[model samples]
Target chain A: MDIKAYIILSLALFTIGIVGVLVRRNAIIIFMCVELMLNAVNLLLVAFSKMHAMSGVAKASPYFASDAQVFVFFIMVVAAAEVSVGLAIIVMMYRNVHTVDVNFLNRLKN
Target chain B: MNLTTLVFILLSVMAIGSAIMMISSKSPVHSVLWLIVVFFAISGHYILLNAQFLAIVNIIVYAGAIMVLFLFVVMLMNLNAETEPVKNYRLQLVGVITGGALLLVLVSAVMKIDVEQLVEMKVGDQGLIKVLGMNLFKNYVLPFEISSVLFLSAMIGAVVIGKKDETANQ
Candidate 1:
């Protein structure tokens, strides 16, 4: 399979995720969108890693190898952690405001 | 098309469709369900890439655990279809345009890359769990330990944030 197709699909998913995060009023959905974006990037990163591994010359290059996948593993851990904290904050916001709309979260505004 | 290509096409379609549904559905529960489908499709993609370990972890973490938490939160909130706010057409238009612009940029960037050069690199068989474990325990140990700390912080934050305010009653 051509790598371009995979890249395109990842880009599309990332774009959709960006739109969802920007337009959605619900905090939970926005958080999901953020996850979607992260997943899309993860897909692209893994694809690049595979592409590099398949092409033998990348072995000499310090940046290319299964190490990229290791980076991706860390990214997954970080993303999971982020979602946990983010959802907790969202829950706190809901407790005080009874709503999760981003536009209405203007308490800091003087 | 070969089996790999065929599987890739199918999984691509499934992933994209479910992701679209995840964003478009009015019901949050329905969206979470669609997200589960997306997660499964992504796991299939990982399998296609020969990352068997990643595929299993993907299903276990995202599909099995995280999604269950999502569903539980959705149910606990009692968020019904009626409670969802409707998106205004103007905001939707802006979102579409912004998203479209980002997509265009990414597509163009990808198109300009040289795939043949990338395909010239030799793939090693050292991508399996054995090699990965060796690398993680040897070279990447610091990052690995740091990630556990990060997870600890996140857990503490979740507990503090989710805790009910006892003083409010007084």
Candidate 2:
């Protein structure tokens, strides 16, 4: 696989995700965008791992060898946990406010 | 025009298109469905990278479990397109500009990297299951052990937060 192409596509996805989170008023859409961003980063990390693996230095450097995949694994775990907690919070917010609009979440404002 | 490049092109297009659709769709349920498609496309990319285990886990966890939870939440909330609030035009413009700027910067930086040097690296043949299993069990065992604790905490947290408050007047 062309690592650069993967990197570029992932970057594009990440950018779109950022925009989605920023522009969208719906909380569910924002959560989806956050997932998109996380997936994008995971894509880049895997590409880097493959690139490093191809370089043969992965075996020499203990950190580079298996750590990349391990790191991705940890990231996946964290992302999963985050979604559970985050969606719960969103559900709570919606139940209380009856709206998922981000702009109306200004009840904390003085 | 090689197999890798061809696969990359196909998966990238599918992933990006579904991602865009996930965000842009007016219906929340439609967005969740599109997100599932995006997750599958990403798993395809993982497979192309030769991480078969990761790809399978990716599908099972993200596409199957996580997205199903999202769909349930949307349905339980009774969300519909008409109820969704519309964002102001100025914020929309700013978002598009910001996203475009970030994409330009990232692409330019990536373009500056030396691809030939990266390609010179020798690829390993240890498939996903073998290499990751050995490494996770061997050198990075501590993190592997800690992850269980993390998962336990997350489960508890989810239960606590998701529990309904019956005493509080609705």
Candidate 1 yields a Cα-based lDDT of 0.80
* Each model's chain A TM-score: 0.89, 0.89
lDDT of 1 by residue, B35-103 (tens): 999989988888777766667777898888877887877787777689987679898889989888988
For model 1, report DockQ. 0.54
Clashing pairs in 1: A53-B123, A54-B121, A55-B120, A55-B121, A55-B122, A56-B121, A56-B122, A57-B121
Per-residue CA lDDT of model 2 for B1-170, tens digit only, reads 77667777888899999888887888999999998998899888777777777788889899889999999999999988998787989988999898999899889998998875342122354336777888788887898788888888888888888888888865
Residue B154: error of model 1 in Å? 1.3
All models, DockQ values?
A: 0.54, 0.59
User: How well does each candidate reproduce the native contacts, as fnat?
Assistant: 0.51, 0.57
Give the least accurate 10-residue stretch of model 2 chain A, judged by summed lDDT: A58-67
Worst 10 residues of 2 chain B by lDDT: B118-127
